[model samples]
Target: MANLYKLDILSPQGNIFSGNVKQATIPTTSGLITILAGHTSLITMVSKGDIEIMLEDNSVKSFTVIDGFLEVSDNVVSIISDFAMKSDDINDEVIEKAKKYAAEQKQKNDNVPSEIAEKNLQKAIMALKVLEHNKLKRKKRVKY
Candidate 1:
């Protein structure tokens, strides 16, 4: 049997995920780290990046998180993020719209463009990157 651990991810909106996972990879301020069934207790700041969760059945799930905190204790992992969403839930059309809005904001020639525009642009860029990476991963899986 594969070692399984508890994983719970929460965001301001609501609970994102809560279930058993074989392992999980998280992006922290120090970089990426993979936590297994018996990982030592840890508390770390989560950076904006991709988080991968592997289920006991070997299925993989991915999420993109903005900023958050992660804690691991007694085989349970908890994550609280300012923003988070499954990579599969990301919409390309939404990302493109964000980019276009940011560009329009910049074209306004405001010495310091709108903060909302910048944030939207950044999120859009990150989502796009994750999407691209997921595509590559899927392609690699198909080739094998």
Candidate 2:
């Protein structure tokens, strides 16, 4: 049997997910970090990215995460983020609209700070990436 780890993903609003997962990967400020059963303890800041969870049954769950910290200890992983969403909960049309809105924001950001505009663009791009990655995962599952 695979070792199971307790995972709690929380955002400011509330808990996003809490359960046992075989493994998880999250993006940190430095880079991507992958955690497995019995992983050593550590905490690090997170950036805008995806959190991939491998369920015990070999299925996968994913979340789009932004701005948080990841902690792992004694086979337990906790993610505290400012924003997060389950991949399944996100719709394609919503993401497309967000992309278009981001583009518009960029064009109309003449008075806005460059950093803010860049951040908006980055967030929109991350959303698009999450949708694409989840779609591919779902397709792979359907194939198998």
Candidate 3:
């Protein structure tokens, strides 16, 4: 059996997830990082991407997170995100809206910071990727 540890994912809305997980892969500013039991303690800034957790039961859960901070200590992992949503919760309408808003923001030549537009675009793209990946995983499981 794999070692299990506590994982808590938090966002401004509320606690997104809290459970025991065998492993977790997070997107950091530098790159993607996978944490397991007994891993060394660390703290880093999370990037816009999918946070994948492998549960003790061997099932996987995925969440799309925007900018945030992640801390690992004493076998406990905590994620504080500005925004987060389960991949299954994302819908086409929301994705399309985000894309349109981002494009509109980018086209504006006013004082709007480009970072805002870029962040929106990144978030939309990341959500789509996570949704696609989850769909593929489900298909594979069905085939087996």
Candidate 4:
């Protein structure tokens, strides 16, 4: 069996996940980084993308996280993000709403701050990507 390490994911709303995981793939500013047991202690900035975790039972779970920071020390990984949500939590309704809002924001790009509009659009796009990835995973799991 693979060694497990503690992983805690947090957001302004509060703790999103806290438990042991065999492996974790985080979206860092540099790019996606995979951490296993006994990884070097370090800290880095996180980007907007999906976070994939391999649980003790080997089940894979995923979440979408916005800008944040990650710290790894003593076999414990902690992530603090502005926002995050489980893949399963992002349903079709939420995706549609985000898409509509993003389009509306883009249409008013001239009136709204470019940076804010861009950030909103990026977040909405990230959410959609996460949802699509989850759907593909589900499809692969369905045996004929």
Runs of candidate 1 exceeding 4 Å displacement:
100-117, 141-144
lDDT of 1: 0.88
Instruction: List, residue by residue over 1-144, the lDDT tens digit for candidate 1.
Output: 548989999998798899999999999999899999999999999999989999988999999998799999999899999788899887788678768877887787777546667676778899899889888988998999
Q: Which should have the higher TM-score, number 2 or number 4?
A: 4
The C-alpha stretches of model 2 lying farther than 4 A from their native spots are 100-111, 138-144
Candidate lDDT scores, in order, read 0.88, 0.84, 0.88, 0.89
Best by TM-score: 4
TM-score of structure candidate 2? 0.76
The CA lDDT at 63 in model 1 is 91
Tens-place lDDT digits, model 2, residues 1-144? 659889999988798999998889899999998888899999899988878899999888888887889888878889998778887777777677777877887787587778777766776777778778777978998999
TM-score of candidate 3 against the unseen true structure: 0.82
Consecutive 10-residue window with the lowest summed lDDT within model 3? 109-118
Q: Clashes in candidate 1: how many?
A: 0
lDDT of 3 by residue, 1-144 (tens): 559999999988899999999999999999999999988899999988888999988898888898999999999999999789888888787788888888888787657787887788887897778768878988998999
lDDT of 1 at 135: 85
- Expressed as tens digits, the lDDT of each residue in 1-144 for candidate 4 is 559999999998888999999999999999899999999999999998889999998898998998999999999999999878888899888878877887898786578888777777777888888888888878988954
Error of 2 at 30 (Å): 3.0
